[model samples]
Target: MLQDVKSYLGRCFAIKDLGDAAYIFGIKIYRDRSRWLIGLCQSVYNEKILKRYHMENFKRGSIPMQDKLRLSKSQSASTPDELKRMQNVPYASAVGSIMYVVRCTRPDVALAQNITSQFQHNLGDIKRELRVSCYSNAGYLTDADDLKSQTGYVFVLNGGAVDRKSDKKSIFATSSAEAEYIVAFDASNEAV
Candidate 1:
């Protein structure tokens, strides 16, 4: 199949001589033959970022972001002096590097990554909500803005979220039921 693909592409795409794709785009791939398992990681990439930021010896936090933290545009640099200082901070690059790790291996960090990247120029509050029942389990709004509600869902297959979304609902949902419906519809669409 690979040979056929190589022939079809007609040499424009050069297949690297890397021996079974152990690494691709900063992700390290691993395979277990007897267990029939394949795993992906970005530990090396993560370490590189940490080193780049001079945090190689920093203590690890138990949680990436604390729950119930609020971020707003007001927090952005409004003055020219502040903007100049921000330019030297490498905030965007750090967030982007973090995003790549989130995309490749750390699904748990999706919400945090979303909030950070959205406000790359400007962003945090966290809320913890657990589902108690189908009807009663509508948890706290992950988004604090009154204009829109955020909805996130992950479709887990073989222990990974193969298709996942963390985004705002297209329209404002008036009630918890309406929000639930929108989430259901989004999840089902991805399932199909």
Candidate 2:
């Protein structure tokens, strides 16, 4: 069937069969015919980014960021000397690089990515399984600058993350419960 499709396409269009795709847009592809599983990885891209930022020598951590960590504009370069020093740091560039990874195959880091993204001016894992499951969470008043709540959720299908999001709520939540409700609502919307 695959060959027939390829032949038909070849007859109609100027196309060449590249055999199996090993990499697309820098994401490595792995195939397990016995298990009928295809996996994607970006470790090489990740390493290049780390080396670009001189972070290849840094220690690895289980989680991207510390729990309860709050970042705001207040933490940005405040003094003239601090601003001058920050001028050399590619804060926005670094964040943009990692964000591509988050969008592709790193839903676990979504929350951390979202938090750090709020300060682009300042700048900053997974399992496989079968059943589909979703998780929703929110941080009440987590944004120190705006006092806005943070919402996050991930959808896992067949042991892999299919969709995820992390962003600050547009409106302020007066209570943690409210924040939770907001996240739940957002997740429900995404699920549908």
Candidate 3:
């Protein structure tokens, strides 16, 4: 289905040129000058969320969540839905900010956000785990920009992400093994 709403908005505004969409403040824009192909992105908005959050220099880990991060009592999983659960240990803002980033650019980040958002109300264990240091299941996807765009996935079994991404898979995979091999191939290509 047509997941993106901007195209709907475009029809509403009846915008002729899709060129000026790059610098809408909350969005990121990448344009192929030679090809005159413009790409609109929300990365800037993600960065802005970080700035507004002010967690830019704290500590950037490879994954969004920690290892073996649980939802036991007296932890971030407690409370029906309260913010007092998160006491110290910085980065909730960053976590939330990244949620927005993932919402904009990455769909694989869904699992991470689901696990982290639980702590939105209760983050005690989250803060403690990160401090000492320490992790759900979910999938999230935002409005895709282009037609048949390949979504990026960063597989994370535990809190730490085993993989990170730059681009989406190029070819369509017919099976799970093919998908893994494709990602591996993509990584190898990027490594070169």
| lDDT of the candidates, in the order given | 0.68, 0.81, 0.53
Candidate structures ordered by TM-score, highest first:
2, 1, 3
What is the number of backbone collisions in each predicted candidate, taken in the order shown? Answer: 7, 2, 8
lDDT of 3 by residue, 1-192 (tens): 343566787778875555445465476678898998876577557556656766556654454555565665465445544444345445566677677667666776788677766655445543444332211111122224422223344444344555556454445555555555555565555333
CA RMSD of all predictions: 15.6, 16.5, 13.6
Best by lDDT: 2
Predicted structure with the largest TM-score when compared to the true one:
2
Q: Tens digit of lDDT per residue, candidate 1, span 23-68?
A: 8887889999899999998889889999998889975532435446
Model 3 CA lDDT for position 181? 57
lDDT of 3 at 135: 14
Clashing pairs in 2: 129-158, 129-159
- In model 1, the Cα lDDT at residue 112 comes to 81
Please provide, for model 2 over 66-144, each residue's C-alpha lDDT reduced to its tens digit, 9 standing for 90 to 100.
4356566766777788778888888779888989999998887888777777876743101222455789999999989
Local error of candidate 2 at residue 125 (angstroms):
25
TM-score of each: 0.47, 0.57, 0.41
